[model samples]
Target: MNKQPGTSGLIFNEPLLWDKSREGRCAVSLPKPDVERADLEKDLIGDAPELPQLSELDVVRHYTRLSQWNFGVDSGMYPLGSCTMKYNPKTNEVQAARQGFAGAHPFAGEEFSQGALKLMYNLEQYLAKLTGFDAVTLQPAAGAHGELAGMLMIHAYHAKMGKQRSKIIIPDTAHGTNPASASLCGYDSINIKSGDNGILEPLAVAAVMDEETAGIMVTNPNTLGLFESNIKEIADIVHSKGGLVYGDGANMNAIMGIVKPGEIGVDVLHFNLHKTFSTPHGGGGPGSGPVAVGKTLEPFLPVPRIVKELDSYKLVTDFSDTMGRLHTFYGHFGVMIRAYAYILSMGGKGLTDASKLAVLNANYVKESLKGTLNLPYDYPCMHECVFNDEFQKEYHITTMDMAKRLLDYGFHPPTVYFPLVVDSAFMVEPTETESKEDIDQFISAVKAIAKEAQENPEKLKKAPHKTKVTRLDEVAAARKPCLRG
Candidate 1:
């Protein structure tokens, strides 16, 4: 089937590279082998590899066209709540691609990697100061990885105190990774329900805190986009019971310089640098989620922390009660470089402005859609807003249908059916990076969709008429995934 361009002339139905290859076609020229004749491994080697051959232009156009087909934060506004899909700065990209950082070997000696080491060291310090933590670890590779590292450290801290606490208090508003991290550390996740106002209440947490409890895993400005204002009292309750609090810093984008988790009584927290620090996200790989802690959990940090020693910087693996290494190298160095560059570029006041603007933008969008949709929480949201399929459900409309219809309007859908406490949830997070004009356009599109949902219900049911492919049978696709032809 012939497919129309989605954006920037992304031609579809392009032939496979191998399908265009002729037997003798070649894209690159190679010199004759310099090895001795006796070096040929005829006795052990198998058949020669079957490689595709094409002209250099053909190779370039093929990948470039494919990249055009893919949507990214740069391509348009992505309002995915709890994900913080902000525009990654071009300046940060330039910094990350610097020859000094991009070309460094992970296995090279510390003397040869002083600049990279120094960057990492300074980054650790910046994160520590920003989050109000005593120290920070850039070991964990991503947000979930950081969660696992933090949970294990929590387990270790309790174990060192001669207690076998095994239950972790996870609120319903948490990202799914929270309980998974707790379970991975051999702790049972005791799910707690948030209050009717969509924020975690101090009384609800007090009812669950006990001797066997490890701690609470709470996300500030939670999935509902409402801040847990009673965090300090909640933390005190957990601490009074000899437990620790683990803050999931996924929503750190909402509270950058405005609030620090460490000062709010969190013993341990992990920062999603990929989200808050303008690094590339959405792809499965290349993310950084550095964990920071107060003095209590500092001893259990990952091994080989980059430290400064007089004139030179070096790695020190001297922690006696460390959680060991989380990655082979010092996490994703390129990602860290992007994050560090973001910090240096933004500085302290700039970051605070980012948080303020993020909150302002979200409230602006929320006000634009309030009462038109189901405002379940109905309060000021920090960096995102949550709505349910209230009025739309009367017409048999669902969050999924609304999401699919958004594609036709040239807007990516907000996260749907998430933070399960909200019924038929639809969450939107307009990060600080979005301009007021772009936000107004998004608000207009969503309003139009709501109007269309009431007037012509069938349109949403069969949405995305302009894309390369129409609505997909997601259930069938999931149940019978085609791994290969």
Candidate 2:
């Protein structure tokens, strides 16, 4: 109805650095070596590698143009559904870049790096208090890593009781990583389907939970965007059968200060600092997933754990039942610093408000777009909502087509065909960061695309008409990747 944000405008056409390379071009003037050059042995030498030569201006303009084509949460609203791609505050970055935190060497003695140690010590306490767990280990590098640590601890718990369990219970509504994490720990995943209402039913969990099962891995405010209301009962069932409960805290963004997993009978849980704690999320390197556990599993946490004795902080590794090391250093220290900054900045009340606003924003989008999109579950959702192409199916327009078309509207697409249970699922999570106006624009774009599906179905088929790089052959790209050196 209105001029969409994705409408095409002036764009610069640029070429690769190699294509622009010339014989006499040089971006830098290197100084002559002061030391004498020594010849290496023939065995140690290799053929010279080909490299591009370009002017300083050429290199600067090339990268600057490339940056203009990129989009991020800072550039626009990122309703990336289950991912929680919310705005990461710049304050977190500032705190992380501080000299003491950033320059601390991992191999430095505890006495030399007391500031970093103190930060880690206090961060562990903050996380434990937030999640209502007895103790914590900031070793695991990511959510899946945290899950493995949790399962290993669960495995250790059962083994300590003189019997090693063989299986783990995972609900269909749980994160996709749950099964893989369980498998890595040598536990056969007993997958159970969620109830028709889109949440795990206590009866279904009771049927699969047994002494042979190590525990249950559940993603609360599950992938379908519905909360698992029967979690307490399910936890009770698992505990009664001599199994522990492993809560996948990926969706903790939706209930930060409101619900503590430990109080809900979860024995162990992990916090995704990137997802829930305002740390930069994508591009993969800087992620921190600190696992928190109850008294039963605390003894088996990862080694080199931070502790305080009298007036000083220390990293000790003498725990006999520990799960050994999970990272090269004490996890990603920069990510920990960012998360610690976020937690301290938000405090208790701010975190509660964030959860409340996240739920509110998601429901707002759900209610606004349900008329045009087919909502698989009509009930109240937590931090995200799942829609599908049922309404556009008659037009032969699919989820991928609509997602591509959203790019034309100047918005990053919400996750599509996920949570696996719903057919042609289009999951949307508008985190607490977006404004009402921005969300309305997103809703308008989706509704406009739905209208185009009926009026001009072919347009949706050849979608993303305005982007520099249009629709790609994603399947071929994944299967037959072209890696260039």
Summarize candidate 2's per-residue lDDT along 251-306 as a digit string, tens digits. Answer: 99999999999998999998799899978778765788999999989999999889
RMSD of each: 3.3, 2.2
Residue 272 accuracy (lDDT) in model 1:
91
For candidate 1, which ten residues in a row score worst on lDDT? 1-10
Q: What TM-score would every model get versus the actual structure? A: 0.94, 0.95
TM-score of 1: 0.94
lDDT of 1 by residue, 445-464 (tens): 77777888899999878987
- In terms of lDDT, model 2 sits at 0.90
* Candidate that would win on TM-score: 2
Q: What local lDDT does model 1 show for residue 190?
A: 91
